[model samples]
Target: MTDAMTLDSYLAAGGVLTNPTNVPPRYRAELMKLMATFVDSELAGAAGFADVINQGPGIKERIAAAKIVLEKTDHADRVLKIMGEFGADTDRYATHHPWTARLDRKADIGATRSEHDMRLAVFNYPISGWTDAVVMNLLMSRAVAEQLAEFSTVSYQPLAEAFRQIAPIEAHHGELALEGAVKLVENGASQDMQDAVDYWWPRVAVSFGRDDPNRFEHLRSLGLRHSTNAALRERWARSADEALKQLGLKSPS
Candidate 1:
């Protein structure tokens, strides 16, 4: 904020950089990676869900599913435009990979990513059916909410502002998923719903990634991250468990 402030000191003192030109080279690289990861995950998530709109049990369910697909893709676009400010080939980046492509349902790749994209590891697995899709959406939405909460506070003003505007919309997607799950339970799929929860919990948990203190410190110095991965994962666990309990569904072991 002061005229003589260095970027590091400014960020450490809670200053925000409003433009791409204001960012240093290393900060720019990390910010690009962060944006790319989010964009890839959103595109992949939307693509996976696009296939399930017809699998919805009713018109309302189908409408919710379609809206989610639309909004998530929109969210990706908003961030990708930011990436474009850094000279990334936005057109090529969008079409560079098959976003809809997924691994076999039984793939056990853990948090390892496929060769071509940076979508979270959890997205690599295919959605099995309506129930499975609902569960994945609900759980992943909570994780996304936590991530957005953190991202919304980073030192990059424009990207942080983008996430701030995005957090509420993403939260609504989680709410829609929760509502859909409750409908499934009321319609006599409670047990089946629990099974879906069990299937997705671990995969979603791993998407939080492993904690590396060194890496966290490095990123923190750049003002790109405030909390460690372990902390965020634990926070999401509690949030997910509480959400599951309200629906009378037990959290996975």
Candidate 2:
């Protein structure tokens, strides 16, 4: 069998590629794109959240926000290091894009990425205020948890190991958001929290993007993706809805 066929067969049999040298050209391209998207999103997310750290309502909140910012930057660094093994210029890549740049709150970009970065479209919209920032964090962190769960099983062993280590930290970020939301609700910010939820629900929902069966099938065959976008989106929606309900809020109507 050809090298590509042998690689495909091995991946199909649940084999893992441990290093860049073992990655085929096509797999390398897709893997690089995946890693770029993740690193870009994390960097953009950290930059945006950093702006709101001072807006947090209390010292604890600020600390939590700061922790998130620091850890997310670390996560990006981890993935970018893996990309560097593929000859990516890690230094230039991190600074090449204006990670903090965002569109107007009213911009309707859907799931499309911005021209200069691969961040999810949800991050492109500005966080409105303290309440809005908390709400956005709660929602988006859940989405991140779902995506990380899927990626933790990727065919690239090193990347998968990085994700495995990062998953719990990301999940803890979600827990912090939940604590913040509960506190906000108890402080009579229910209406404000709900408004933020309504505003962010659809935007965060679209970050899962649309399902493309053909593309999904191809990625699945390569051990790059294990679930359809729609399935992951639904999982996120269910978890998000439950989180809102716990806060005595509802998903956008």
Q: Which candidate should be chosen as best, given TM-score against the real structure? A: 2
Give the clash count for model 1. Answer: 0
- lDDT score for residue 198 of model 2: 87
Candidate 1: where is the Cα deviation over 4 Å? Answer: 1-5
lDDT score at residue 171, model 2, on the 0-100 scale: 95
lDDT of 2 at 230: 87
Question: Can you write out model 2's per-residue Cα lDDT over 1-253, one digit (the tens) per residue?
Answer: 9988887888877788998877889899999989999999999999999999999988999999999999999999999999999999997987899999999888998899999988889889988888999999999999998999999999999999999999999999999999999999999999999989988999999998998889888788789999888888999999999999999999987
Question: What's the CA error at residue 56 for candidate 2, in Å?
Answer: 1.2
Q: What does candidate 1's lDDT look like per residue over 18-86, in tens digits? A: 888778888898999899899999999999999999999999999999999999999999999999999
Clashes of each: 0, 0
Q: What is candidate 1's local distance difference test score?
A: 0.90
What stretches of model 2 exceed 4 Å from their correct place?
none
Query: Residue 230: error of model 1 in Å?
Result: 1.2
